[model samples]
Target: MFGGVTIGEFARLTHLSVRTLRRYHESGLLAPATVDPDSGYRYYTADQIPTAQVIHQLRELDVPLADVAKILATEDAEERAGLAGEHLRRLEAELARTRAAVLSLRRLLRPHDDTLRVELRKIAARTVAGIEDVVAQDDVLSWYDEAMAELDAAIESRPLGPPGGRYANELFTDGRGTVLVYRPVADPPVRGRVHPVHLPPSELAVVVHPGPHDDIGVTYGRLGAWVVDHALAVDGPVHETYLVGPRDTPDPAAWRTEIGWPVFRLAVTDVMPGKNPGQTGNPPP
Candidate 1:
């Protein structure tokens, strides 16, 4: 007998409801100290207060019930520490996602009254020496890292400029795509996927995207719409030239990518002003 405090009295003392206490009993996490068989009532002792408080704190932190039971049952300090640490890491990741979303929302709320600048320019032919791969869209990031690492390993000298570029083509409409990575250099290796692919000189509608690659799609969409608004049409797949990719630049905000949509110049004004042909621009609010 926990100094003979009934379930109702224990709930009041612990700031927990009687229903919650019954649930704890059913889950066997915080069982009552005594049971009155004749009345089918549960009673808790004052001595059980510590255990009840621990359960309450864990629940407040949104710990899983099973995990709370495991923590309470485990006598080893190291195991409990590891469990808590793992949960903390998960919580931190969730916080990071929330923060990113909030920042994106703030950008969206700002005025878009000013017309986005779009210019047509001829890109000169350039030689880029780097590893290339036909990577699936889902595995593109890993493929990018691996290709860059391979280039780094085989190179006698690193590219004298920014990390370089990724050329993407719509191989599969839904989720699959092929992307090629190229770095500016005089000569590249002959083995593996490392072969010379000439980038033809073309007139491109260019927009500078300064931020993480995660949100470049938003910029792409906006630029595409701007091009359409000006009566232009993209005639080919888009190109992304990373002037400051992750390997070369650590800060995401410092990363600059020139998002280019190859276009055929047009003079028609009949195209709808608000229609977004390339939903790649600043992310949807």
Candidate 2:
């Protein structure tokens, strides 16, 4: 038999609104202890107060109603704790993503009075320990992290140069293509998805992108514009030189990356000669 206390009393005890309690009752999440046969009034007991309070807390954390029901219905305390823990992990992941978005937004909305300096460099062909795979655009960051970790483990000696990557043009235009990450090392060996790659000499229009990679797209956009305005584009994979990165510094402000776009040279830049045209360090503001 169901015990008796008015639904309003249960709502007050739980600090939940009467309307919320009614919705929960209709959804079969928190059924009242009793219902009057004639008046159709709902009833609850003092024992139901804790269950209502638990449900309220779970809802406040934005747990799905079905998951909330499981947490409530489970009789074993350990089982309930496990259910709560799973949602806790999910909540933490969401909070991290939200914080990253806020940081990126702040950088994007702020005014940039500085010009992105672009350099013309001709890199010589070299052999290095590398990994290459076809990957989707969304998976680049995760893939790079895994590949770099593997590279670090496989190579024991000091690196000849900083780590770098080549992102095929199709990867950006078509959303998926080849990605290669490497560390320049002398006499690199072939081992478990890591092998020696002979990179061909090529010319690049390079720009240094500063800070965390969250707003890196902005720098990319600026650099691409410079390339289009100043030189003939070469159909080659885009290169990124990790100068000062997460592996080198914990502070995001100190991170510096060189974004290099492969290009064919024009005899003269597509610039209007109103002043000194030799100034290539900083492009048009």
Candidate 3:
């Protein structure tokens, strides 16, 4: 400890715990400028304060320990800044997700009166271009993005109707299940992974989920309760129609999704099944 300050002063100056400095020592993220062989004391040079502060800031941002080490080891100032910047972007994304979750929780607890609006309609049988896959619940978003992109590329013509997806209950219950995404095209052309999917005539209890899909679960829960209260029995996979979404618009506030449950005794006026199921519409029952 001859050339550098004692660990006690270093801790006070850096505002870090003595134990933390020792841990950082063991982890090799920060090393003492000198160590006394006889007394086993650690010492850090005054110049090391800025590096310690940087490590503290990075740790506060939740950067991984390995990344912190890599950043500290970087010699070029620009390269170090770039590494830290990348982690900042990731932290920003995490903060956005956290904010979304908080807003969803607030809406769930408030229970909006208009959130329960339900529309019962008859959907006729039809064939559409689709891509099907068995995806884990966590992977659904990414898989949907890729599938929808493929569907869009294959079906260059304007969609006859909004794109839709059929999700099996097992996707939520057991965490993995079949998910089918389809675009209503006048004539479904099969190419690569795209296939013509035949949908059956179904009576749906539908509800509109407004805004970003982050809180769509809230709308889904309310719709399920409505179905139960109305004595409607869910008979098939849940249907989700993207009336307005990322593919059509960049603004999430303008996105509108239809959550439909194919149900029995849905109180919908009957309609004939045909190739174009969308033509079948009944007054909201």
Best by TM-score: 2
Clashes of each: 13, 0, 0
* lDDT leader: 3
Those runs of model 1 whose alpha carbons end farther than 4 Å from true positions after fitting are: 1-25, 28-102, 131-136, 167-173, 191-193, 268-285
Candidate 1 lands at a TM-score of: 0.63
Evaluated against the true structure, the overall lDDT of model 2 is 0.86
* Better-scoring candidate (TM-score), 1 or 2: 2
Cα lDDT listed for each candidate:
0.73, 0.86, 0.86
Please list the Cα RMSD from the true structure of every candidate, rounded to 1 decimal place: 7.3, 4.2, 6.6
The alpha-carbon root-mean-square deviation between model 2 and the true structure, to one decimal in Å, is 4.2
Model 1 collision count: 13
Query: Mind sharing the TM-score for model 2?
Result: 0.77
Task: Give lDDT: candidate 1, residue 155.
Answer: 58
Query: What's the C-alpha lDDT at position 142 in model 2?
Result: 87
